[model samples]
Target: MGSGTPSFLGLLCALLTLRPGSGFYLPGLAPVSFCPAGSSSSDCQVNIQLFVNRLDSIESVLPYEYDFFDFCKDDQEKRPSENLGQVLFGERIETSPYKFSFMKTETCAKVCTKSYDVSKQEERTKLEFLKKGMQLNYQHHWIVDNMPVTWCYTVEDNQKYCNPGFPIGCYVDGNGHPKDACVINVSFNEKNTFYVFNHVDITITYHSGEGEGWTGARLVARLYLLGVLKKVPFQYLWDYILVSMPHTNIQWFSIMNSLVIVLFLSGMVAMIMLRTLHKDIARYNQVDQEEAQEESGWKQVHGDVFRPPRNGMVLSVFLGQGAQIFIMTFITLFLACLGFLSPANRGALMTCAVVLWVLLGTPAGYVSARMYKTFGGEKWKTNVLLTALLCPGIIFADFFVMNLILWVEGSSAAIPFGTLVAVLALWFGISVPLTFVGAYFGFKKQAIEHPVRTNQIPRQIPEQSFFTKPLPGIIMGGILPFGCIFIQLFFILNSIWSHQMYYMFGFLFLVFIILVITCSEATVLLCYFHLCAEDYHWWWRSFLTSSFTAFYLLVYAVHYFFSKLQIIGAASTILYFGYTMIMVLIFFLFTGTIGFFACFWFVSKIYSVVKVD
Candidate 1:
């Protein structure tokens, strides 16, 4: 088996000849220009290189190196350096043997060939493995200009679907059923055989280097195979994909729908705060009506609502974790909206979030310590320790379990021991110490002052109605927030489970804000009702209320698994849910903390403004 010389294999089309010395920057995918490195722009000939990325299947969580399929190999293969996020994602990108010259155009070129005799066991085994890859429907991922080379085809209803990767091959089953790609030609009609794609006709579209605001030559590469001349993608989901005509209208409609819901919730919250609450405060503050007024409504619970919640230590820990997740999510989505984490910078989003979470230990510790102190707890050491270790420990443990599975399965998604050690070092060395520094400062500062003082004896709580019960209220609180993002969640799930590209960061950021408002208002609404009913245990209730959104997320995930996904085998199923639980936990903390702080502020403001004597 060896790479063959480039030879025409299909219909010839337009041939492009870029200037020999034209300089072009291709971010993350290949060279900065069509010239050798360190050469002046005018002094070099074209040096275009095509890179091959890891082959993956939607049927499995694992992705493999380009060389795993044994097609073509660079005589001296070179791999670009990968960042931590890329490594974790199993992005095994390497130089391909397919070479291009500036003045040349190749049509349907043969890249490599492998001839095998069934009598040779080693070659037979290799052939069998390649067939297995076809059976599993693994796709080849080619890249140019830091963008995936797209293979576009017409799906049902005459709509064009551009896939970022193309199938390695197609297989015809014993029953004479053919996979989608096998229908390209009658030559592939033989049953029980695997037909491989040995040739590709690549069309490269480019923005001239001299274009205004151009940092480099921007290129989009597409492969037109057989007679299927599908509409090519200008970029592999250029992040501008959603802003296209039809997509733009649908996305804006979704945004408007969500905005209406958010505005309605905000209006309700504002009405409660500005109108009803004002009347309640005014009537209560009447010179002689204080005592009677204090015996009813939310005002009655002021004395005990501020009391330390049960399981104060654990609650504080969760709050710390939530704070960390919230801040990390905010900054990540914000950066993505600013185009700093565009698809052009592969793996930058995860890297930025991880770095932000690691660096945000100070705020986590400060919030946890301050809250724990406000709860009147004296176990300062234990509080800080839990704040630093508890949530991260659980996540790491889950991740370790998942990694073990990946390791046993020989998946590249498995984290190498050295990388795991580096992560642990980041946690213990940087994050933990920052947590300690924050705790020290938090302890030195005064504990947060409550507007109203707690009585020496706890106030007797009244029985709650079904709707206002702890379980019911928490469960209900998650619904509205989840509603705000469920549409967005569908796109996110498609990106993860279905291998679709998702780059609508501005839309996501808007949904994030709406989710925040929904969570805050829903929790506040419930907290007020609970208080009015004279159930003063609001601390944990507020946290759990918003936290239950994660439960809804879990439910939706389960629904998606059954309805939307075609994943099979126990390992893939477990892997999917295992990863999902991690997401759910992080979301739980993020939302719960938002609700907790919002309710806390509401309680404080209401209590502070009225005379509590």
Candidate 2:
């Protein structure tokens, strides 16, 4: 990698290393000044050191160390300690050869020139690797004073967008087809040749501490290479690049569109609760001794409606896991919205998520044990074990398979054996015990009291129409909820695959709230209509209704892979789907749990208020 900043990711690296500001400064967060090499002490000169991170290509999931690609490595290679999140994300940070002093004007000063003799097989291989890096658009991430080294340029409407990393080089095929970087310069037009960005001129800007009380200044640095080139033309590195910014109008319109649907769904639910249910209850209660009740409706099956569903144990386990996922997602989003996980904080997002999930075992076990007890289950041991192990096991297995692929490819993204062991220790040593403690308390507390009692013998129900069949209703139930989030989903997937900045947490949190409301209302509405048709087997069906939204999500992911992205290679395809499956599973649990609880509450409230003889 080269000399520059990595925005938030760099901030995280700085937080860990905490070494640079050797001068008398404001703890670890201050910006140290720089000056020309011959400056006196009165000039307040600061010696600046630039740090380089991992080199990554968007077309490939694998990232490599800066030194791996035969770039100019530091004479004294000093690697800083990495945190769990940094390690997991494959951020390999090390000192770079580029040095600067504040206000030091650097022109065509030569860096180490690299050469490869094509006749030597080893050198040919190295050259080929460098070309491959350019072909796939590998980037060098550099950090300066805890800020990303941004390359800012004007786009449509004269708006400027800054990119965090710069490319290694540019290439053109034998047919004269060129990448975007190749078209910028005429000298790079040769066929089947790699044009390296060897020479760079970086500009660093900083806010003055003139009026401020602080002696050190906060840096606002940018790098632009216009007039600087290598004395030997062929050997150079990281510099100029640009990409257009996402339009705000479309994103806002999407949010507004989702809001309108949510308003409509909310009105429908309000009408059902305030008007239809109110009249239904009053009318049913007023039925006298002489007038016989209809044996074909919901009231006739109150006894069997409360019966435990098939695979009660499995249902409880799912509920428990869903609870954990729901809590994890909510808290993570809330933290992001509050700027704790902003682009300035780097890998705080992943670090926060992993830590929270490990600590949330209590809620999972508690919800599972309570539900199982309410189902009149006697096997508490099995219930607790399933709650703690089942879903987590599936996730770990999937993760392990993906990690194996990374390992086989020798990607830096591979988790070290030590980190993997640490994760397992956290799971079994901490989370499992916490889950058991929650389950014990859950069991000690009395089982939830149902409003209606279960009958010794289950009652037979009548046939359902095409409209009211469980499959049709469940299928229909997911449409509205999916509609509310599909547009947002597009942006989210784009961020992941394209490596774009995603700091739109406020809108995201709002959409999250809307999604939850839409899921609940849709499930409740469907449950109500089914009960009117005398279907008392509402337990598992209610959960499946909202959970099917995740299926739509999976379908959309497949469509996105084909339509929106140009991702090639079997490894990339496998990695994409593997991660997508994990997301889908978590979403299934989260949405399904939401629908089930809402339906359960609705069923209990209706049966409890009406006169059930």
Candidate 3:
């Protein structure tokens, strides 16, 4: 044990050296200014303090592991480490009051002076004006846990800049270029006593570009806490700046429109299930034998109702994959709730989920192989391998295509080549082998025997009414679950595309639970009706019922792209659908499996308890 300790420590050191950003650190970019003790001049020591609280796990089901950066370190290139700034509250100092202010430089003055002329000519414009004497551009953002903090930017000092609010507190001063002279003040309200002395990380990004209008430059700052700060005291001064901006009524309207559509679909499904369908089922079943015999539809196929579904091996494979998806989703959301996958962790959530899913392939294979055996499937090896590779391969291929497009477009969202290779290794090396092992065990088990025997002759299905048909019912079944999520999906999309933070896993988990219950109940209810009508073909229909939500999701994604997003071009559109297909495919499996099992149980119960001729 003692000998191993040194080796473990060596490994830890190496890991830390390799991944500096993975560990806890104060929020925001390193500061350009630092105040030494005994500095008499206030210009050199503007006190800056930050308070971050409300730390809770976004996920309700997973353990808290700060090791969320496991998937991000694929391509390791050592670039010149630019000084982000000085760390006021590093691991070395536990308790410290820090002051940070930008220094006056010639370049800073020149950048600010040029902006002053533009502001003077346009008095009506509320841009961040810099005088010939200003030196630094300062911007700050205050985010309340999971909420969005909106910002805008400008160009000055040959740099891109942004302010937290209007009338930018940051400006270019007398310097010919940009300098770190701006000071930002921060403090906590009286109610924010729970967090103190805890280090919060902050990042400030600068961008320079020339697009629409006068050369564009912008600087933006983000802040986050490293640990929980319960009941701590801190104070600092804040400079309030104002600026003119366009109202975002259109954006809000688009969100509202999506909500309305979701609500309308939900209401229709609810009405059909709760009142009309329920009453119809009871009334139809209460009819006398002669009348019931005369009435024919799904009831004609009653004798073959217990016949085993075809292609059970494929279905089992799907279920296995669905189980993996379900678990992955559950754990991801649970961790997000805990703040481990907070916006500050960029790509950490995806990395964590993929890693978890890969590790979980054993269960997927085990479940699929067991089910295939129960269905009397002979090709255990093929079933297991396909279960492991087929669906995941499709998704990965689609994702790779999208990544290629992103790479071409120089989009920030593209996954790197090394990460892609890591993904492949995870799928083929770990998940696939585990799946085969699971299938081996599953093939050894006995086939499941139905309580009611299947008839030799096929039962003829009667013509279904428009509402009773599979297409309409399946389409209708998805509306309720989608309603529960469409509102949440809006925020998720915003986070993914608009570069906003999403930390509301609590609400998301609830919605997920609601969706599960809704899908199960809707599928079971529909299956029961068709069964009573004597239809034995409920197998595929049941699966399709809940899986239909994927179509709705695809439709909504298209609508969102067209109306809500500013993205352009054929490649962007193709990339969007390529990714959307992965999401839809996963959803199809999850909901379809839920419906299948629920209906399966319902059919088994009804048939086992009924009196048969």
Q: Mind sharing the TM-score for model 2?
A: 0.88
Q: Quantify how close model 1 is to the true structure by its C-alpha RMSD in Å.
A: 4.3
Each candidate structure's count of clashing pairs: 1, 15, 72
Q: How high is the lDDT of residue 18 in model 1?
A: 41
What are the lDDT figures for the candidates, one per model?
0.76, 0.76, 0.51
Preferred candidate (TM-score higher): 1 or 2:
1
* TM-score ranking, best first: 1, 2, 3
Candidate 1 least-lDDT 10 residues: 1-10
Model 2 lDDT, full chain set: 0.76
Provide C-alpha RMSD values for all models, in order.
4.3, 6.6, 17.2
Off by over 4 Å in 1: 1-45, 107-110, 119-121, 183-187, 209-247, 287-295
Which is superior by TM-score, 1 or 3? Answer: 1
Give me the runs in candidate 3 sitting further than 4 Å from their true place. 1-302
Model 2: number of clashes? 15
lDDT of 3: 0.51
lDDT of 1 by residue, 154-273 (tens): 567876666668887778887778765777556666667666666444555444445544344434333344333233232343432332213456667778878888888889988988
Worst 10 residues of 2 by lDDT: 7-16
